[model samples]
Target chain A: MPDLGLEVLIKGNNLGRLLGGLWIAIEISLLSIAISIPLGILLGILMTRKNRLIRFLTKFYLEFIRIMPQMVLLFLVFFGTTRSMGWNLPGETAAVIVFVMWGTAEMGDLVRSALLSIPRHQYESSESLGLSRKQTYFYIILPQTLRRLIPVSINLITRMIKTTSLILMIGVVEVLKVGQQIIEANRMSSPNAAFGVFLVIFILYFVICWSVSMTARYLERKWS
Target chain B: MDFAYIERVLPLYERAAALTVQLGMEGILLSIVIGLVCALILYEKIPVLRRIVMIYIEVSRNTPLLVQLFFIYYGLPKIGIVLTPEVCGVAGLAFLGGSYMAEAFRSGLDSVEDIQRESAYSLGMNRMQTIHYVVLPQAVSTSIPALLANIIFLLKETSVFSAISLMDLMFTAKDLIGLYYKTTESLALLVIFYLMILLPVSIVGAVVERRVRYAGFGT
Candidate 1:
């Protein structure tokens, strides 16, 4: 039948290059995750506060992040800022910034919802038990909130990982970019290299994200 | 940002925005149809089709739309199934949007009570009639918020259309910047055009959600 061009994947150092691209994507996502988690927790706590200005500001932040496409954010940071602000920002660094911003907003919202979901009675009972405010949070609220947050955070982690694929647009040599490079190099030798390379890249993304999501599902089921 | 440059480029952004809306709408409509069919198949537990739909949903949901677009636009030509960039863009959007829409509709379908179906049956209604007259109304009403959110999401996702060489808003902004190096003006206009497109939708979605919440239809 037709040449599927699957052989291009195993040709020379192509497979290794693809894997290296995957690692770069993972590197950006992992960096964003490590930074956003703590900052997001703080933002989430602030979200649950009763202060009017704080609530409004946090809500605005969340809505802004929600409305803007991550692609635009990436472009603004990578292309716009370097020229406008006169700062030499690399694609990887710009990606981290945008991702951290997006991730923190998402994670903060998750935290706020988790915190709010704790029954009012739990708080009332905690207060009546004469525990200090800090102690009440430490002993009662944190545990429940953490339990609710873990599965969703894991899901967000997978989302972050998947979205890292967009970084390739800003000229970052992520996995998708590397796949393109391989396809371009093999264009003459393998007429169908694009199909084969993209298919493999798709599988790589699927495997990583599918495993991460499965873990989240498992946690959700185990806890529920 | 340069005011003169912004003024001159306004028409271009406007045209790009119109195209973005057009393609996004086409994709969203197609996706809604696809999603409903998938949701119905899943809800009905239609044997092998149900398993296939499940696989489709998981695969679409897990993968980024960018890669899917690349495959459709670049990869498929190898096998003689070439599609235009615009078609590929819309197809990619629909492919991803379909899974999400299916999820929203499936949740709505699941929320329909078995008792409602039994009552409909007792009244001499067939399965199809019961689903059409009784189940869909309530399920759709409850699913309004989710469907609206998905619509907005799908609209925002149109930004990625530029990657495939579609002259959408993102493409316009990037082209202007590349040609003139007016990065701030191009990006500022990009943000404004996007806000002009999305903000109204967000506001309208909220209003519709509120209206549906109070309408108490099917409840």
Candidate 2:
């Protein structure tokens, strides 16, 4: 009877806690992407400039972010920078900052690739129509880029949402952290609760990511 | 920039780098085996098994590697399934890497056109033999670039093990930053360490991608 009651508890409050954590994960990921996509597009355009130095600097920044682990980047921005510079940042703020930085670099690369994939004929046609370079980008290149960018950007969003689990280490009360807390609290009372909690966490993540992937596939098929 | 601090920490960083490399290599190896097996199971198209593998891959791929590590390291011990930190770290990485690798291989498998599969069958090869001798070899070649990129991604991700108290290069850097407060220098060195490892891997991936492209598997 006691065991049955415990199972009921897991299926109820435990499930609710998992859902709450997932909400925070989605919130953070969307916020980070909201900052990253526009910044990345602007940076991507700056990176393609004819000026040599801007190209070099943007290339350097992209490569730096690419090679470093996001966790280390999180730690650097959250812990080291705050301590060294005497600036205070909440854990979620730090997590978002690091993710936005990482997300921006990746989005920049995707934008660059999308831009490069645009046919030269389109640019020429737009120019022949007497559009300025700025107008060509705004009216011609940008729309096509957005069409191609949607799938990759959605993939990035999924990545960001998954990666936010790391913010728990820096003390954000996200899903995984909440799972850990619940497992800890119930360890003595319920021996199997830890695995049960983790299983729930895993399922929650799978559902969110699976839906996002389905959306990406739908977008890809529609656009194609 | 202090020579004394560099001298004091160089050996520690080197040792940690060696451990990091070892962990990355072991994790990649394990992941390849696990991923290949899981991929083959899905390729076989068995009903229940395919569904299970799909669920496994999706869950593993969507979750953060750090969260996975913590779950294994902290959560498992509470269940009396204690693993050493190194073992736990490697297992976590392998699980995460395996999921992505399975996706890469599945995409590779998808690239082999249906016409080829029909031709292989017409040649009287059994399904397993057809996959083994025809589809898989081509799929592997087509997938090498993506596989290598995932490997590099996995290598970068192994740095997350430092958070769980693994003595990886990132861990060493964190320790130095803690002790000496040389945040800039320590982090710069860690960045260099990552660059040195990843640059070569990226070049290799690029070379493989070019070759794959030249082979006319553009799709």
Per-residue CA lDDT of candidate 2, range A5-123, in tens?
A: 23623554777887898798789999999999999998888877889999999999998888788877887897778877899989989988998999899999899889989998999
Q: Which regions in candidate 2 have their CA more than 4 angstroms from the true location?
A: A1-22, A183-193, B78-80, B121-124, B216-219
Native contacts present in candidate 1, fraction: 0.71
Per-residue C-alpha lDDT of model 2 across residues B10-111, encoded as one tens digit per residue: 888888888988999999999988888788888778889899998888778777787688768865775568999999989999999998888888878888
**How many angstroms is residue B1 displaced in model 2 relative to the true structure, after the best TM-score fit?**
2.6
> Model 1: per-residue lDDT, tens digit, A1-224?
77777899899999999999999998899899889988888899899999999999999999999999999999989998898778999899999999999999999999889889999999899999999888888899989999988999999988998899899889898898888888888889998998888888888888888999999999999998
Which candidate leads the pack in lDDT?
1
Q: For every model shown, what is its TM-score relative to the native structure? A: 0.97, 0.88
Native contact share for candidate 2: 0.51
Evaluated against the true structure, the overall lDDT of model 1 is 0.91
